[model samples]
Target: MKTIVKRSSVFFLICLILLMPISSFAHGMILKLEEPGVLKVEYDGGGFSPRTEITIYDEEGNELGKGPVDEEGKFHFDPGMKVHSAIADDGMGHRAEYKEGVEEKNIPKVPVVIGVFAVIAVIFVLFNKKAKARQQ
Candidate 1:
């Protein structure tokens, strides 16, 4: 009857919602080089697409090395020479790249910490002086 149809429709909608992510996750990749000379790659989808290709390049755009990822969607490579960047491709147009080097920082940490402590000390001294004046 009408109740049976309603329950079936609800179940169908729930199934569709669960399967949507799988299709949406079909693309995307990530490349990282946490350690010097070694690069790591991962895919964004639920799991890595096997045999995904990866290429390494230097700052000058010279190819350093190239290889395929393992079944786990993870690839590790040691560029015999220094690499300035790396790129990962899932062969389906999903690609990602990372460049090596430190990002420019305007302010240094040590000076900032010292400045904060100095401000705190000045505020404490002013408060103590005010408290004493009120007592007198």
Candidate 2:
């Protein structure tokens, strides 16, 4: 009988834990922009009590859009013009943007693979030197 009571209490606690909001402690905020300049930002809803305000900005430091996050910690931007950057201050400022030359820089995989392998080789040599010193 005592074991059964303990198990029931544990089950109730687990259910409460599951029901709690997991996003409350998460700092993994995300921002996305769709084609023709539609932006979306999401957060864990930490700073807002009634709902937090989000602001959009341009590369020229101009305000584009402003709104609040919904109950689900989600926001949408419907800027009719092209957007270069977005800024959000949910206590910690979140910033993102679309760069002008990004499309041109995203070239084919040959250059990217060579760059990645070059970085890897430099890191490996530095670590290998440290390991050899420790062994000696």
- Scored by lDDT, the top model is 1
Q: Can you write out model 2's per-residue Cα lDDT over 9-94, one digit (the tens) per residue?
A: 56655764686555433354445454454444554343332244667767797987877766654556664765666654455554
Q: How far is candidate 2 from the true structure (C-alpha RMSD, Å)?
A: 15.5
Per-residue CA lDDT of model 1 for 92-114, tens digit only, reads 87787888774323344457556
Question: Model 2: what TM-score?
Answer: 0.37
Q: TM-score of each candidate?
A: 0.48, 0.37
Q: Which stretches of model 1 miss by more than 4 angstroms?
A: 1-27, 102-136
Q: Assess candidate 2 and give its lDDT.
A: 0.54
lDDT, candidates in the order shown:
0.66, 0.54
Clash-forming residue pairs, model 1: none
